[model samples]
Target: MIVRPLALCLTLLLAGAAAAGDIRIKDLVEFDGVRGNDLVGYGLVVGLNGTGDGLRNSPFTEEIMANILERLGVNVSGEQFRPRNVAAVLVTASLPPFARTGSRIDVTVSAIGDAKSLLGGTLVMTPLNAADGQIYAVAQGAVIAGGASAEGDGARVVQGVPTAGAIPAGAWVEREIAFDFAAMQQLRLALRSPDFTTAERIERAVNRAFGRSVARMEDAGTVVLDIAATGARSPAHALSRVENITVEPQRKARVVVDQRAGTIVMGADVRISRVAVSQGNLTLRIDERPLAVQPNPFSPGETVVVPRTDARLEEETGTGLAELAGGTSLSEVVAGLNALGVSPRDMIDILKSIKAAGALHAEFIVR
Candidate 1:
């Protein structure tokens, strides 16, 4: 019943009159030289309720603790300390483009040692460095863990991940990336999905908006824009204007199937040639019945056991040799498939067979 309902919905979707609309240029492409940088730092999280790393098992945790105490002007050079309320963690954050000093960003804290949990811990002031080995931000705040855990003598229950957490707006930016966006003579737009037709459409749309040939398609994946031709005050102004232009993007026909969930998704342009399909199920039955023989009282000597088995093969009569004509539209294709009266899982197998026979004409993806 569920399969039939799903098929009906898909048929209706194909038969609908609605069509895909145009998309803004900003949503379709990424601007060159405008991206984020990854920043990471090793730090310590404290104030856990006996759920931190064991000092005996994690020597690095003890070493970092000693360093932190030394930095705070506390002399613990020779004294031994064992603390169950601290954990070693790695703090990570992304420095967003155009981020300036004093701006705060979010950071993720993950336990790097054998810590039980990071539920109620507070991250120490940790300096986050970028790929260039320069400090860009400092993170320090109370962690908001996404999950929780509890343990008894013999059992433990954990829901979600208990050792990883995040701090919102917890890192303060200290350095700025030196990128002169205003002085750039040109900018490039990189398509998220490379297509020659989409790239050409974007080029034409941009030039039409300015009434001049300002943007040119460099390749299927890139479009180069001449900022001077737009006559904007700066490169930023030129980009701001170009990013608002809308264009319809073209995509390839594709079919994706998830065998585990018995689901299939097809693009509107997917088509199938004339084909014949037959489906049936064959099942084997096996049964075992062991018999026991016993001696009569005051009569025979010993008891005997015997075994017996019955096995047979059965095949159910199914839809035989269904012919599907070549479909001119998506609705016809789906209608023909549904006419076989098969479930989605069975339809997936049929599609695979059709593709093997060179009848299905779309990119097939199985997951």
Candidate 2:
């Protein structure tokens, strides 16, 4: 069982190593300021079949509904409403980099009140605000929930999440965030996974692509780019030429285990030192059975109940202390462990014990 997975991982590692010559720079790092901004807003969804929020239970829904009605020139200041066809929701979207006015972006709507579902509902115009407390975009469209729900008198069924949905091209961009990506003299590339070796390789790759020392490593995670030295008209032009340059990334050896799922994942760089491991488990079982006692039917004082239990203990055999030589590769380590013939759960315990004994040469992580 373990040999197959380790063999698969070994094959994948070898395939990846063969293609480690170059990776696109854009895939390796993030260009500073070229990112999206999260926008959120409060909104209302109408047109539901009595599955919306109960006004009595969620008073805020009533408040927002009344506010919306009043804003639309309907004078219902003191009127009470017990409608079950409207829901209060939160609208969220991301303003992509270089978004212009009139550009459309997708938005997600989630129920904030005790609404049963947001399906078959239309969102009224809602203003999305940024972290700076300024309205950035307005989202309004029909919500297409990814789930469905059905309920009878005594039972209910749901698939996916009915209280949340999305609308593609739902929000129209009204204003653009101020950023000077073109006029920037220097640009910084932030590595997605910060590593000194990877960052240095990226710096070297970028310089080699430009045929000059245009990029330099600032830290383990950041690489500074001299846009002026690239002799490009703008920083955008300089970045276009640099992003295609690929460099192989470096990562630390790691082994992660999910105990609840009995899953173990190892990196190609994982290794093991010489050690011996013993694997076994003791299992105990108990069965309860109640015995009934009765006197002769005609002359019975009373019927009596007696308790009885059966207990048994068993230990697995054929598993004992097995000595393993030093494993310089992930496959060897996995093959060594697989020789014990234990389940994944038992493998987790053995790996933990090996790590505790300082015989595991990789970082051990448990989830």
Candidate 3:
């Protein structure tokens, strides 16, 4: 059977049209100032199965250990010691908005020293502090490391990250952030992906939902809301009533390509202008054949080898220009590209070239 190179095939499918729908307001924007706060603390992980930090190399670990021991009424001053049962670590957690005192939150612990692993370990009492350097919560729990490590005398093996672990509901809130969510006069909805069209749509949809002009576009990224206009008891109540409102969000034409994974994604808004694309392959092959040269039977002359190389060039047949009409929709643009009949990598090159030539009518992003 003769193998023929792929030819440009114009296979346009009408069913490939972009879907039309509206998205919820909550999915499109973030509630300004109603977000989590980052909390971090320096702590220690103990009760390890001989996989802790080397006390000598990590002097801070030894110092913290001594301090902890002294706090427990066990004095070890001026004593040199080596132990592999404890590791210094950094504990982190996000203090959610409106978190009440005595509420439990999850915490993550990561080795800050030369600790081998955190499996089967327990994090000591660590005070998590926010940006203000005030302790907001305290965390203490058995560590559930995400990975495992094993070693013998010669070799060792590890899977995932053994130096980091987490404890579910490990931290208990001790202080509450002062935020009057109920006494707010106004609220702002910040777009996750800020766009003038999207923000305007959100403002309009929110106002329409409440049957009044309660929401107004502050900027391309923010929508200011009149909390009193909703006639709700609190800001939370006003938000709850309008968060489910759906609106058609606008998106600009975009083409994203991940060359490492050979993946290409085109937004539904993408379009292509009338252009002609030609794709063909030119292959060059070289083959080496060496021959041994031997002198007449038992001659004194040294044997030698002769090198021969065969080189050839071939251009694939069925190469021609394919014209893509001005595409009004994403399906048409995709059909035009699919007509090129080239591999994804080749398609990426063609896209880049088209972008460089100002032919592609979209934001070309390559990752």
Candidate 4:
């Protein structure tokens, strides 16, 4: 495959330029108390096309089925029942901030039993609870399985996760969190990626927007905002004004490598010192042939077998020791590396060796 050095250089150059632009405070930090809550519940999924769990294999499924029947005033005590259309499932949903009662939210359903698939299943009325053990919402809807499955007596094929599914707008909120956003006197902004320079910039940006010192950098990861000093109506109003302020955020030099995909990503600040590198590949080949030797016609009785093998070691001609000049910019670094005429997978190894030699001045991460 032909390697496009110019395209790679341009991509790195553009990435460096993009990082220099000012970003909004909202994108760099999160409001401390403004977040979503996770809700989970154990429930049952029904109406499957014979893909439900085996009652004998999953005794929990049988127990839950009996409980549902009894709750519906149907006497199932000591009754032997085997159903192939029901499965036990775990329902999960996120309660968004400021969600009001009667509001609808989406939910995910995952089969916890040995059900082959959850396709065409409907979740029963399941009460979702939060960490406080309080019922927050109820979930019940038709499941949209992520994949499909086909099976027969001899073979089976499944794509994606057929046992997990999702339902859009499948739950109604029954309670609201007790936090009063309007009554807050102060609010903290938590940085998604902590950086002292970024936090200071955010503090300055917010204070500049309010024309006063209403924001302070508590640490590398936190910036506190004084709602009363902003002269805004409430904490919500103050945050609305502060979050829109723009500031240039600082980032560290980092090189990320995804080995499976042969992808290499480098931040704008990544740097490298002048270094020489050599790369090559070795291939080992082996072949085996079994020969059967038989006695002459109408002569001796036994047959003999002989084994033959061939093996060879070969080395591919690679680019000799190449010099990578120290780079002051991302484009230069990418160009220098590309000049070696290697594929991305090979480039990853070169980078690793460069880091080990103390020539690569950035964090090297391999996934």
Candidate 5:
């Protein structure tokens, strides 16, 4: 059956319409020196219902427990301990820029043991620290697990990631990062995807928006903006106004192929040179049978037995060699392949062969 319209069948992929809604200058370019820091802490989740870690497999669990108790003024140095109601977890969160003490933030907790699940668990007061080993916040809250499990006798079922959970506003900030964001005079708009063309576009867009030559393309990946000269209060306010400006981002034309999934994706600009393709398959088969013969009971053949084997070969004529024509447009390329009347799986191989032949001008990616 025909799947495409006759008149509009030619493949035409083009850049979509420009984005809407003002993207804040804060989103477009970063104040050269302002960014968040990542914090991580090792902690424990308790109050589980018979699904915590096997203390034998994760001995460090006990070590941390002993340490916690010591900090809380409990002397357990000589006590033998084993608990199945607690699971060791790694707590992680990002400290946002300009965060102040008393502010709340979310944290993620993931089991670091053989715990079956972290459901109905509560994280203890765990100090989250940065790479500098200084505590910035403390996390503690009831875990809202996204996954769970069940087991009874010999049957069990599970869903989602029961070993990982998260807490909303679970951590309290105790310190502020030392940064004078409002004092900066310059900002850098880093292109998420670095391209010389895109960088120039961003530089031009920023300068045009403010009617001043405040932004300049420093390199393919970075654009430097003169915030002080842009007439804004400071770096922070300047970014707030400029980040919403729009600039077209450029990207190279590419063809992505998932070999395992037999999927092909091509960009609008992907082009191909003239080429011819041919495909065919060969098959060979063999059959073998074994039979045993026993001597007659009355025969003087000592009741000997013998074995016989037989084999045969058969061949089926393959769908003769097929040829595919080179195509200029994406639609033409697909139609040309369809002319060969081969399944998509076979078409994938043909595309690969064409790429190896240097006839496919676009990037041919095999994922």
Candidate 6:
């Protein structure tokens, strides 16, 4: 079991070994302003092999097609329009941290109209927008669909999502977010898990790096630090130097159990108080039998029907209450429940009952 792997974990915890406390600095904290920007755009997909949206149902698809034709000097308004080669779609992508103009990024395209499929389609150039309604990037490339579809007159088969696809490095950045990460005088480290003990550990670890107090805990969740005090020329260089320090973390005790699936999850810090538990199951079944009276042959007599029912109730009892001492080990908890001759499914019910009786000290979560 995965839990047994941690059984030997106590040796490392009890030995007070400094090597066991090592952790990646990236896993501990987040830089204050290093983030990504979201970009989205409206676009048209072409060369769909006659599996595109219906022109009548999605008028926007036809309008977009007409506009594209007009841009290319192909007049279509004077003629009847029936196109099976285009689909209306929305393109979305994320601009990475420190993205520069002309830098390419991946994009996801999903059909917004009643497009039957987007397979073998090519995207038209579309301008992506930020929350401020400003164009930030433009996307245009051959679609790499992750799905396929086939349809006949009366039957159709589809595997995977044929209406959505992805384009790798399909969008070029048209703008750059203005932020100078290397020139900051003060930088903040945000703890992923905000505990006072963990924050103090980080502060001490960073201060020990410079042989002076360069970091301080601002609150339970944040640690503020002076960049120049570390004697580094740039914030980038200082952060690159500080983010590798490792520290031991403090976690809360918790136990989570799923009722429908008969699954249990326990944290390493979870503990249980001494308690007694007994469990059993009772079942009842009912059955019905129909009785009928038959009329005499060639006689004008009415037929009558009668009903009967039988019921049985069976009770399954346990041996007796199993007692556990205070601060009993998890192995002991397993042993006591095993004595009742109940499997994990039954043991889940028993645990719920024990927790409800205030005997189980660990937090009980039901899903």
Query: Number of backbone collisions per candidate, in order?
Result: 0, 1, 0, 0, 7, 0
Residue 257, model 1: lDDT of 80
Model 5 spans > 4 angstroms off: 1-31, 282-331, 335-339
Of the pair 2 and 6, which is ahead by lDDT?
A: 2
Poorly placed runs, candidate 6 (over 4 Å): 1-21, 150-155, 258-262, 284-293, 301-313, 324-351, 358-367
Residue-level lDDT of model 3, residues 1-367, one tens digit each, is: 1233332222222222385479898888899779999999999999998888998789999999999999999999999887898999999999999999999999999999999999999999999999999999999999999998999999999999999999999999999998888888999998888889889888888877888899999888899999998888888889998789998887777888776666778888777778888777766667889899999997689789999888877777755988878888887787787788776667877778778867888998888
Candidate 6 lDDT, 118-143, residue by residue in tens: 89999999999988888989999999
Q: Write the per-residue lDDT of candidate 2 for residues 1-367, one digit (tens) a residue.
A: 0122211111111201212356788998999999999999999999998899999889999998889999999988879778889999999999999999999999999999999999999999999999999989999999999899999999999999999999999999998999978888899999998999999999888888889899999999999999999999999899889898878888778888876566788877888889998865555667889899999979948888999888776665755789888987777887888787776567777889999999998888889
lDDT per prediction? 0.89, 0.86, 0.86, 0.89, 0.77, 0.79
RMSD of each: 4.2, 4.6, 4.3, 4.2, 6.4, 6.9
Q: Candidate 2 has what TM-score?
A: 0.92
Candidate 5 local accuracy as lDDT?
0.77
How well is each residue in 3-96 modelled by candidate 5, as lDDT tens digits? 2211121232222222333344445555566678899999999999989989899998888988988999999998987878999999999998
Better by lDDT, candidate 4 or 2: 4
**Between prediction 1 and prediction 3, which has the larger TM-score?**
1
TM-score of each: 0.89, 0.92, 0.88, 0.92, 0.81, 0.82
Clashes of 2: 1
Clashing pairs in 2: 23-246
Superposition error at 185 for model 4 (Å): 1.2
Question: Model 5: clashing residue pairs?
Answer: 23-243, 23-244, 24-243, 24-244, 25-242, 25-243, 25-244
lDDT of 4 at 149: 96
Q: Where does the lowest 10-residue lDDT sum fall in candidate 3?
A: 7-16
Candidate 4: what lDDT? 0.89
**Model 4, which residues run further than 4 Å from truth?**
1-20, 295-301
Clashes of 1: 0
